[model samples]
Target: MLIYPDERLAVFIDGANLYATARALEIEIDYKALRAHFAEQSRLVRTFYYTAILEDQEYSPLRPLIDWLDYNGFTLVTKPVKEFTDEHGRRKIKGNMDIEIAVDMLNIAENVDHIVLFSGDGDFRRLLEAVQRRGVRVTVVSSNSTQPSMIADELRRQADQFIDIVDLAPIIGRKGPRRQHHAHYDEREETTREFEDAED
Candidate 1:
């Protein structure tokens, strides 16, 4: 995280992207710790978390974590997944929150001196470039430590700084007693697996 105490800052979290990144690092981020880590670095004005939900089941798999984040200080941004059948008759859910993340970052660029982005999707390269044009410094957080780096080459190169998620373990990983893998959310769920083609 490229944070200086005096700088004004905000965080934009791409939910699915972050979950997978953290998993690749073999760590679970304590949300409260993650937020406090930034708060200590700057005057954190906002932390926006964006994700898509599949409504097929009566109860979505992510409801618990989603509810927790909303009740916390973080701003929860979500969109419903649209179901469609492709030409091959395979059902796919379409719900990408990239626009939401990009728009919020640009909207607040003037108010913030720094941005902490938690996803490595290459598509955000243009967004980062645009925000830089508006005079905001960007810190991209993802891992190159994975088998095939989670961050895009251009996005990582374009960022003012890139902080691999593994490096953040000591700063944000779980502390104290944890019971029965209580913190483990179902990583194999559909939405979580959708990133298999992240490079595709």
Candidate 2:
């Protein structure tokens, strides 16, 4: 991660995209540590995490993690996912948060000297360009080390700096003894995976 001591940094996280990327790399992020790591790099202004929730469900498995993040130095932005049938007559859930993240980044651009976007979505290339015009440096964090590559080429090119998340796993990822093999861990991972799968 490129860091300047005087830079005022803000983080915009595309929750589903990040979750999927991390899963593809077989790592789980420790949110608190990730925040602290960035804070150490510069004047951390804010960290925004955006996601979609299925409100119709009796209980959401992600509620615990969401609540944890909300109280742990993250600004949570979420909305209910919309369910609909496509032209092919297959059920699908719509929960894209790209606009929300772009809007927030634009709103905060003037205040922050740098933005670290945690997404590989190519749709954000224009947003990054707009933010750059305002003199804010943008750092995209996603992986190209995955089997098929997680970071979109255009998005990577648009960024002022591209930091692959796989390289930061040692600093931000959870350390444990084969976490995915445990039932409890699988339940939580599955919850995140379900939404991310729908997103992609």
Please give the lDDT score at residue 154 for candidate 2.
Answer: 99
**How many pairs in model 2 have backbone atoms within 3 A of each other, for residues 3 or more apart or on separate chains, i.e. clashes?**
0
Q: What local distance difference test score does each model get?
A: 0.83, 0.86
Model 2 per-residue lDDT tens digits across residues 2-120: 88989999998888888878888888888888999999999999999998887998867667778888888999999998877767776767788988998899999999999999999
lDDT of 1 by residue, 73-161 (tens): 99999988767676787766666788899888889999999999999999999999999998899999999999888999999999999
Off by over 4 Å in 1: 176-184, 195-200
What is the TM-score of candidate 2? 0.90
Residue 47, model 2: Cα distance from true site in angstroms:
0.3
